[model samples]
Structure formats: structure tokens, C-alpha cells
Target: MSDTITWGMMLRKLPSIANAIPRLVKGMKVANVKDPTQTCGLGWSFEQATLRNPDGPALLQGEVVLTYSQVNQWANRMAHHLIAQGIGKGDVVAVFIENRPELLVTILAVAKVGAISALLNTAQTRDTLAHSLNLVAPAAIVVGEELVPTFSAVRERVAIEATRTWFIADQNTCKPPGIAPDGFINLMTACADGCADNPASSRQVFFDDPCFYLYTSGTTGLPKAGVFKHGRWMRSYVSFGMIALDMRPEDVIYCTLPLYHATGLCVCWGSAISGACGFAIRRKFSASQFWSDVRHYRATTIGYVGELCRYLVDQPPGAHDSQHGVKKMIGNGLRPGAWGEFKRRFGVNHICELYAASDGNIGFSNILNFDNTVGFSLMSWELAAYDHDSGAPTRDATGFMRKVAKGEEGLLLAKIDDKAPLDGYTDPQKTETVVLHDVFKKGDRYFNTGDLLRNIGFGHARFVDRLGDTYRWKGENVSTTEVENTLLKHPTISEAVAYGVEIENTNGRAGMAAITPAESLATLDFSELLAFARQQLPAYAVPLFLRVKVKMETTGTFKYQKTRLKDEAFDPGKTGDDPIYAWLPGTDTYVRVTEQLLAQIQGGKYRY
Candidate 1:
């Protein structure tokens, strides 16, 4: 889709804007970031919802359903149990659970006690798990039944003691005694005799106080724990839930994304609670079972990641594709290439693609249901000219960064102030890495988003690419995201991971792509594939090397594992069984790269 919004399109969206006025007013009242007197947090929001819709379905996972009152009371009981175990305000409790009602219940319980729930990535194990555990230094740990084995393996390496170790059964145990491992204490069982009343500590939980510690998806390296404060979650509730979806009690948001992530935990869940709506969660995403689950829940909305949408689109067109009640979607990374296809296929009215880092203050939401845009931000922000090589904002002779052209791609910078405060990573040094001091003017601070965006029109902008992900090739810059999106547009390419690779004698990095075909690589048409990339991309932007694989590896959050792919490059030894294809210089067709040909190419046999 074009970044420019035509007059006709703007006129069409005028009605949507008109309809959003009341929501905007109501949302602003709750979302007063500048108001010092205002105090909003997760527990406060949940308790308010209990008053509004006590009997309504608050959470659903398969046959297990929890009402607002039931969920609140259960969480309260667990809160008392935790307090009894000597856990108090600001203490970190590592919640190690998969997608389940109990996971959320545990988080709520911890929040009510004014303790921080360090949402550990369930995918983590061994050394990585120990690193994350030791980093947070959780005073207590909640291990899910399914994940016990994994956690048990690394338990010896961690610091927490058995007295503080908590466990939740795979099944509901809130009302009855549940079985626990020898060394583990059943959280639900312990809470059975505790008070079910709302804790006074919930009200004391301030906006600036850290509510949860969400680990960043470790795509580039070891994951960093990013602070997710109550203020941020409340902002999401008012902005995404109250304003964007205006979720009603009848609305049920089906989420298949990992609950540990902000997109699922805060954005989707917060939205549901904001309107006293139902929230349905699945253990993990299954593309084949996705639609079935949606239909089962009678979901009115969905929480998605771009990859999930792509997987659904990749599913063969069936009669039941558009046979669901889903009207809205809220999440991030729905690529422009697949946005239209997803909308057209699924028949969802609003694809509210959002843009926000767990560690960053600024957030953009597609409240107007705009196509191909991350939508708009009300926060003070700027698009600044940047140096791709250094991956930093480029400043002028006056030592001030200039704003990018209205429609050009630039590094996104969010102004850090009293209203838009940056509750960054746990490590002070890591947080400092993202803080841009004296950005536009003396004494002015900006949160370097490290993302490139195109300012389309109004307050909306289209996501371009990650700052470091864009490669300088030849004399021009090439965006890996743009290239990957272009590759995905092809009918045969099921998955595409684009990155920069260094050639032995090349002036700069060359564009390379690792793609997984729908069928075997034997049937893939090289000429057609080359033509598709050429038609959609520039000469420099087109990948010089193409690696065909049966599967594409991704992180827990569904981001491509580019670090490993870049290391393998186009070498047979490094890539193993995966076949490498290359678009050689002066060649019209892509050819297989044998060890004999690879030597010649790397020895500067031909000019690129």
C-alpha cells in the first residue's frame, strides 16, 4: 500500500473519526498522563471491572471459565497467601506459566499485593533461564505444572529457596486441593483458606511503581528485562481498549500470543478489563486450530502478531475462513504486504496494528482502522535524520538533529518528559543505551526508539524497519523488512527472513534472504521468483543470496532469529543441509551455489 493517504480515503475515514469523539473524550479522562493526582494501575482497573460486570466472563481457557467476581476473589485469596509467605511490595515473583487462566490469576494476585511479577519466558531453559532468573533475583517463583520439568533442571543454578517456590496445577485448583511436586507448594491450595476480599495494598500501588518485568524477545542476543509499569498498562487500557476498540461486555478478545509479552498481557487483557469484556487465551498458537478456537469462543476480537496472520493466510482457503464473529484485531507487526489479504480473507472490520516497544514510552494504535499504518500517537515525538552505519540520529553543524521529510523514513524518537516518562530496562546501563541526551536542543532528552518509520499523514505513520536491520548496500540503503515483505508477496514463499551478509571483497554488506517455500525447493520457479523480487524491489534492495529451507526458526514472540541466519550467511559448511541459491552479477536467473562456484564468487571472480 502507498504511504500517501488520498483525499478519497481520508473522506471515507471521516465517519470513523466522527464516531470516535465520545470514546476520545472518555478515554482522555482516564488517560491523563500529565495529571499528578491521577493514579491508575492494573489491580485498580481489574477491581473496577469486577464492580461493573461481576457475573460476566472475565477469562476463558477451553472449558474453564472465570467470571469477573470469581477471578477477583480468587486473585485476592492468592494475594493473601503470598503476603502470608512474607512476599511484600516491590518483591519480584517470577511467573513461569504458559497461556492459561491461572497464569493471569497469579499475575493479578501478585499485582494486588503490590509485588512485581517478572513474567519469565516459558521458552527459556538451562543457562538462559538461570540468567533471567538471577537478573531479576525473584523473591519467589510460580512454576506451572507443564513447565516444571524445564524449571527443575535449572532450579539448582538459581538463588530462590524452596519455601518461596509456588506451583499451579494444569487444571483449575482455586476451589479444591491440587497436587504439587515434592518441593513445590500449590498456590491455589494455600490460598483456599485465605481472605477473598480485595487487599488495601491494591489502592496503594502507584502509577510509577513497576507492576511487571517483561523480558524483551531475545532475537539479537540475551534477553533484557524491560520494566512494564502500572502507568504504561493503564495507558494501554485507556488507549487501545477504551478508545480503539471501545470493548463492550459482549466483546470477547481471543488471544493466541504468549501471555508473558506486553501485547497479550497488557494490551489485550487490559482492553478487556477496561470494558469488562471477556478474554480467551489458548496455550499456544496453532494455525490449523486458530479459527476453530475463535469460533468456539465466539470471539468478537483477536490479539495477533504479524506471523500469526501470515500463517492463517497461508492456510488453504476454506469455507470457514470468514465464518467467525471477529470484528476487530489489536496487536503489532501486521506487515503491509499481508494486511489487505488478512482483512479480505478473515473479514475483520478493524485491523488495529499497533507499534510500541515494551521498554519504550511511546505507542501508536490504528484506532481509525487505517490500512498499512501503525496508526497515530498523541505523545510528543519526531522523525529524525539518522546514520544507518552508526545506527544513531544524524546531527547538523549546530549539534542538533534535523527532522526527516514528511514522507521519508527516519529514526523514531519519543520526547521524554513528565508525561511521557521512560520506564526502561531493569539495568541502569541498559536503559541508558536507549536514552538520547540533548537530541534536538540543549537539555532535551528523547527515547531513541531504534525504529525507522514513514510519516504518512496526520499523526499516523507506517513502520519502515529496525534501525540496524537496514543495510547500506552499494550507494543506497536497503530495508530487510521491506525486502522480506516483498518476498512474502510471492505465492510460493511461505516464510522470508532478510538480512545483510558480508562478502569477502564487497564494499558493503549484500542483501541475503532465507526463505521457506510452501512446497519443496525442487518445484520453486527461480525465474518467476527473481522476476517477483525485481518487480517489487530496487536493484540494490534485491537479495544477492537466497537460502532455501524447509522451516524458518523464530523467537518465542515470532520474530525471526536473524542472528543465527546472518552467521550462517551463504556458506555450505555453516548452513548445513539447507541449499543456497544466488542471484549472481550479470545473471538473469538464480543458480545453485556449489562449493566450486562459491569459491570463485568469494575470490572476487565477478563484480557485483
Candidate 2:
């Protein structure tokens, strides 16, 4: 193979490059412009698309399609209704609905009336659900009728009056579920009498104003709400929607990811609206039905996370697996091990892997279609050497952060400025924790990403692990993500979580992996698993302890929650009946932990 750049690759990217320049120029002008009336909010952008492509399909679910004109009218009517209910600028309207066109309609309607939308996660229940709703202090909540049961369970705790609760019928028949619960108003009935015209309040919305509050995935406790500014939303529209994915007006996007998250909301659906393309949405992701849905919509692009891709790959191979029309795939967390096979099997030509946090100031994109890399960042950023044990940046004698050389792993940081403003959490104190000052110079401030990444050549970087997830074992740093990715390459292990465990006599934390095997508990080849892991990993990186779980626990965005696992830390008493195996020192294979061995291990007898 040639070690030089190919002209064919350059030719393939010319169109995206050509399309990005003008869009970026327009976005910068919008971001910097001061006039609230001139800056285009989400409502303004949608209205523009409606005018240009009135009859084009805006949203799709099965055979149901909502044209841009129809969606605009729906949003207009809902906006009018919300304004009549006394919702306006600065008021937060919480939205708790599933992935349907109405969900987008409600959020867009909230935006049209210059009110902020609080996007609530649908997976949350009871206290978690109530806490999220009350955190934003929403003036009103638009609830889907299908989700009424879950909402009703925590409705009293949310503290919002029944009069302010609006019920949207997920099914088209809309009989208001026979009896309306408490003071809830049927939004379908209300929308019938409302006007389908743009609200005057939309003009008051500005680029700098808070557009919505996206909650972080609270693995340990209640999630923190992060403010997302309209300015940043517009920038994402231009970057990911227009430049990165570079969808055409004729293209359709198949989005299975939840709309509550930024990747699905801003990147996938927002890209479709920005390019005036069709959005094919699902209520939730289904590994079995994914390809069929893609084929049904003739989708040219699909969105994903790493776990979703892994699920798709784990299913039994069939003729229909790669028979879809999808040509482009977008999103983050595509592991290097699976990236090649996924693209080849699915016939996808472009994989735009991105790196960004919901509330963080920095973003990196695989704009050049580079393999196994997060690609180059357009904004200014730095990589500082980090201490694995202390969980902080390693500093020089002068008290400044030490910069890591190229090809070395370090914590990623982005300088805070007007262009790259940190729209931190709703709590000011919580926001202060992520901002670092006087790093390179006095008075200079930067946003800490809390992620470790390798600075590969030519400005490209590969994700190593999260700050706290990378643990020290045997005087070497062990990246949990790396170990998990390696374990996932095995055919039998469907999912895995790698963390550190406190062995009685261990110098540092010992590597342990909790896994969900593909086969029955009796059929899993433990010896094969050990050999495979040993082949792929170094001695220090290979997990010493193996935990077989019936099912793995995950957060809303499909991230493994390691807090409980780390807390348990190989303690048989806390882990219950889950089987634990240990690779003893000088042993070639793992053995089941007996009662005596467990006691001995806990009593500092093992030299791990």
C-alpha cells in the first residue's frame, strides 16, 4: 500500500470542503451579531426551511410523514397556545415525551415563544424523573399520553399544577384517554382552535439566550442540567449539520438515538433541518429492526453510539444486515477495533466520528474521514500531562501545566474565549469546578474536558479514556475504555466494564472486568476468553479479575455505570451471587474464588 495521500480521497472530500466555507462564514456572522431580531434562532431557521421546501418531508416515522409546511403550522399553533398560557422569554418549559414528531414540535414551539426548553430523559422514573423536572422548575410540561403512567407516578412530586400540564396524544386517534388526569389539558384539542402563525415573541429570542437545558448523564446521582445557548446550537448546525456530515437536500437521515441527548437532537435532527432533508425517527433504537427501518426509509445516513454499533454487530449475520441504502454514519464512540468491520460490512463510505460534551466548550471532528482517529479540531486546544492517581494535571515547579508531546496521552483542555464560551451547568458552583485558570499564563482560563486523549500526528487525536476511568495498576496506566474495547472484540463477550479493584496487598488498583457473555452461563468458554484477552492486551493491562453478570447496568446514553462496580471492588459479600474469577500470580489460567481463597485474598495474603 502507498504511504502517500491519494488523489481519489482528495476528490471525494472536495464537495464537503466547498460546502463548509460559506456555511461557516455565515455561522460566524450569526454568532457575533448582537441584534436579537437579526440572529436566527431554531424557530427562525425552521421557518426559513419551511418557506424554501414547504412540501418536502421534514419528519418520518414508518409511512407517516410531516412536511416542512405542516410541521411549521403545528409548531405555530402550539407556540400560540403556549403564549396564551403565559409562557414567554426566560420561562423554562419542561418537555417529557418520546421520540416522535410531536416531541420535536413541542420543543420547537417552546423555542418559538422565546421560552427555554428543558429536555428530560424518558428513561428516568420516580425520584430521578421528579428531580429532573423540579430542577429546571418548568412553568409547564408537555407529556405524551403513552408516558402518562410514568408521569402520573411522579406528577405530584414535580410540583407543577395540573392546569399547566399539557397532554399530547402519541397515537393519532386522540380521544384524550377517556378521562383526563387531574388538571391536565389535552393539547390536541387546544391546538385545533389555535392559529397557525409564527408568534411575535420569537423575535425576542437571541443568539446569546439560553435555548435549552440538557442534563448530564448522572451515573452516580441526580444529573446536573447544562445550559445550551442558541449561539452554540447555531454553530453546531453549521459545523456538524452542514459541514461535517454534509447532507444534501435530497438525503434522508435515519435517527435511532434518543432526542434528549445532544448528539441526536443537535447533530442528527438539527443537521436534517439545516440541510432541508428528511428525518426518519424511531421511538427508540432496535438492533433487530435497525436495517429494516433504514431500508424502509431509504436512509442515506444513520446516527449511532459505540454501544449501539456493538449491539448491531453482535446480532447473527444475515443477508439483510448490509442490504440498506445508508452511505454515511455519524456520531461518537466508534472504537478503533470495530470501526473497520462496521464500515466495510455496512458499505458506509463516511464515518464522521466526533468528540464533544453536551456543555463543554471544545469539539473535535473526523472531518477528513481519517481512520481510527477523532481527526483535527478547528478551535484552539491543548493536551497536558495528567497524574492517574491524583486525577489532576501534572505541574512543573513553576506551577504551570506540563504539555504532553505528540503521540503521548494527556488531558484535553480548551481555552475559554468569546468564540468558545463554556456554557456550564445551571449551578454556578458546579460550573466553577470544570474551569481551570492560569494554566499557560496568568489570568488565562481554560475549560477542563476531563478526558484523556493521545495527540497523534497532524493534529489528529484518539480518545484514551475519561480522567477518573484511567486507573494505575502495577505502576502503569490502564485505560478502561481500551480494555473494554479489546474485550468486546471477543465473540462471546457482548458487553464489558473494566475498572480497578483494591486487592488486599496490591500496590495500586488491580484491573477487573465485569462482562455479559453472549452464550448461556454454562456454555461460556472461560479458557478461551482468557487466551483471547491475553493475546490482545499487555500483562499489566489484562484484567486479573473476571465478573460474569447476567446483565450490565447502563446510564441513559448507554454508558456503563462503574460507580457501583468500583464500590463493590471484588468484594464477594457485596457482589451477591455473581461469579468471580481470579488470575492468581504465576498461574496460566483463572480459577473460581472459593470461600477460603476469598478470605485469604481479603486478608492481604495474595501478592497481586
Candidate 3:
């Protein structure tokens, strides 16, 4: 029989066979690995792989290929130097560096010493940078020489002692003299005499021990440090790397995202668990050079964010566009519309779209080759209705947790108990705010995932929008993601953000959208774009007003910041710089929004 016939027959017989073999359908395996006391989790696995594949490629930087043995030796030497500097178990070491081999070496070294690593975002300014340092209160800070000015600006406000700061000089790059503070140490000088083969000397770390702290993107407000335990990090690797991406030891993974982000740290780092080589690009993502980099590094796999993917797809197609070796790509936030196009254009076989939060305990992955869904979770979790304005769980008079029906959107929560601990932030109050206790059953607890998700089917869920991003319109909740997705379907739009704007005499907030058109489509046909959105999105969800911008402001993680955009809604008088357009229901095209129109809308004369 032909392959197609055999596949068709197998699909037809699956239902009957599934009923006969219930255990197989439910994914119950008879033989499972029994080792429970494996002290060497992911870190030790990498060490073993490095030893076995010493001559094999471990990291590829342009034309430079660093073997596994070389990386292992450098990490060992760095670990010894760190230990000599009084950094050991339970100590918090802050890392502030870009995506480079040195950054990975530093992380591994810290882990070897049983010390917790706190990776700081290099994109943060003085105030936010100081906030991150104060939250962790690190024993020592290791900063890249390139980011010295940023660190120097915030050094006084950081809680760390002056003597604990260390600056890493990139020898290949220029060195700035007098950039380092008086008491700061230099990493090159400190490790100059350290031996590479020093014996490992550290206490065994448990699964519950804090491994790292990733700060949340402060899009809503101030950034909070989210503590990641060893167990959870390991689990993340298993789910994202092993099950989702199906990564193998021979696969070379390319990461352009910042290392500080969870997707880079947990997902990309987890690729190391498979003994795979990871290629780090020590610069911001450039759409033009993306394919060339992939070809240059011979990368078989790559990780991405939604914006990065969109940017790549928007680039003008070239003869060499599909002439790369990338086979599989994994990350979260790939919009449904661009999913198929990305695969077709890039010639990628697998697009593992995942869903997770930095602080939340629950996670989902696209394992069964499902398209447009964040696939089922292997662990337990729940979803319930959440109030946006109050920022709390909504309950009935009977004191029972109200869960959204199948296919409806609701807040995602993870069951937190002895088996699944809520390894929250250092602040107890912030931790308390995330825990929902005694909701469905007596003494049961759940970790509140602030984002909302909708059940798609087959144990899978699709990301809806963040709770703060969703707003009420005409007694119906409007999902920002849905509106944004609709707006993006228009060929002219490159990016879009949907948010609620307050209006006088309005029972609920009005929908306002900001759009950035493709460069080629700069002379936008607003009438056609508006019509497309109106047909796809619900009447109430359609934007009553639109603002055009050359670009949208986003966080380091590429998430659009709505707080600032919402504050500067289409008040033509206040926001005179950017052109504003308004959509009247009956009009074929959107009219220019002027000060007179803004006043009339505020006076309740204009109806959406």
C-alpha cells in the first residue's frame, strides 16, 4: 500500500483501536525511568555531553566553532574563580550581559557553585535596572563591559555592596578606561591565574532550591522578580525541548532573543539537556541578516517571539529566503494568521508554538503537531473567570469558583500544592496576590495566571489576551488579541495594538486601535483595511477610532505596551503629531479625526 493509503487507513481505524487500548490512548507507559535522586539535573547532563563530545561543535559564532571540551574547561575555570571570590551555595549572583558565549559560560559556572543566578535585562534604564538589583539583593554583580555606562548610572541606587561588582571586558571589543567604579573587580584579571580542572566543591542542591530569578516585563507597572526553582526549570526543558521541539543532540539551536527572557533561559537552555549545541547571536535581531545568519551558523533549529516572526515575514521575499537549514522552530506568541505562512515561506517543518508565563506555574506546549493552539499540559491546571478592574477572581454567592465552559475564554490557574509548589517572588505580598485558595475544593490552592486563554479542543487552548488588555464593550468582553489578529489580516498593516479608551457618558470603554502599515504599503488604503477588520471582528470589538504610527513602542520581549498608548488615545489636540482616523459605521472609508470630531465624540454625539 502507498504511504497516503496507509496513513488514511490508520486514521480510520484509530477510533476503534483507541477504545480497545485505553491505556495507550491515555499515554500510560508501562516502563518509566526510576532514578529519583539524580543530583545532577540538567547541569550535569551538559557536563557529561561536553566530555563525550569534546571535539564536536558545541557553539558556533560566525566562523568560530568552540568544541564542547573547550566550553567545559572555560566554565570550570570561571566556576573556580567565582568560588575564590566567596560566591557559593545560596548566594545570589546578578548577570548583566548580552547573548554571547561568555554569558552562557557565566551561567553554567554559577550553577556549578550551587549559587542562584539573577539575569538582568540589558535594555532596562537606570530606574528599572536599580529596581531589579534591589529585588534580588545579589551578593555580587557581573556586568558586561559594553553595558558599563548603564550599570554606572544605577550603581548608587543598587543595594549591592560596592566591592562586589565585577566588570567583564570583551577583549575583542574596545575597552573603556575609567568606566569601572573604584571598588569594582575585573573578571579577566580575577580568573587569569585560576586552574581549569579544579575539583568540584559544592553542596548538593535540591529541586526546590532557587535556581534563577527572571524579572517580569513591567508593561502593566513595576517589574517583579519571579523566582524559578530547579525542579520547575527542569520540567520546562522536558516539556519545551524534549516533547515540543523534539530536539536531538545533533541539532544546532540558534537563539536571537535576549537571554534574560524565560523563552531564552528555560526553552533555549533546555536544549542543552539534549546535548545539543546552541548558537547565540550577541546582538539585536536584524530581519535582513536573519536568513544569512541561519545559513552561516548551519543552525537546524531557532527560537522566536511573535514580533520577530512577523518582522521576518514582512521582509520582501528573495531568492535566498528559503535557502536556509533551519528545520524546527519553537517559541510562544505566534499569531494564528501568520502560522502557516511562516512555515511555508521559511521551509520549516515544525513550528512548536508554546504558551507560558515567567511567574505562572502552569505551562502548555504544542506537542501533537497541532496548529494554532498551545497544546495540552502534562501537568494539572485550571481556568476560571477573572474580573479585570478589580483584579480578583469572581465567585458566585455559594462561594464556588466559576469556570468558563468549554471553548470560552477564562483566566488560567495552576494547582499549587505539595506536589506543585508556587515558587513565587521574594515579596510575600506579591506571592499572596497570585494564590487562589479553597476555590473548587477544600484546602486546594491554585496559582493565578494573569493572562486569559480559550479552550480550543483536544485538550489544547489558544491564548486570548492578558486580563489587563481585555476590556468590556456593550456588556461583552472584547479580547485585544482577537482585534489585533483581525487587524493584522489586512495586507497593508504590519502591526496593530487594540485597547480601550474612556469616553464621556459611555457605559463601557470604547475600542481604539493603533496601526503601523508595511513600508511598501505606507500610502495605506485605509478604507479597505477598515472594511476587512469590520467583516472579521465583532461589531463592538471593531475600533471606533484608529491612530497611525511609523512604529509601535514595545518592551524588550517584543510585547506592545498598551498603557502608554491608551493614555495617549486619539485626542487630536493632544496627539497632533500622529495622524488619527475615525471609522463611522456607514462610511466606506475612515475620516480624519480632528479636534472637532474628538469633542463631538466625547460629548456622546458620535455612536460607535
Candidate closest to the true structure, highest TM-score: 1
The number of clashing residue pairs in each candidate reads 0, 0, 0
Rank list by lDDT: 1, 2, 3
Selected candidate, larger lDDT, 2 vs 3: 2
Residue pairs in clash, model 3: none
Note each model's CA RMSD in angstroms.
Answer: 1.4, 2.5, 4.6
lDDT (tens digit, per residue) of candidate 1 on 102-188: 899999999999999999999998988898999999999999999999999999988898989988888756565668998998887
Cα shift from native, residue 601, model 3 (Å): 2.3
Residues 203-231, candidate 2: write the lDDT tens digits: 77777888889998887678999999887
After TM-score superposition, what is the CA distance of residue 605 in candidate 3 from its true location, in Å? 3.4
> TM-score rank, highest first?
1, 2, 3
lDDT measured at residue 487 in model 3 versus the true structure, 0 to 100:
88
Candidate 2 vs. true structure, TM-score: 0.94
Angstrom error at residue 547, model 2? 0.8
In model 2, pairs of residues that clash are none
Q: Score residue 535 of candidate 2 by CA lDDT.
A: 95
Q: CA lDDT of each candidate?
A: 0.90, 0.83, 0.76
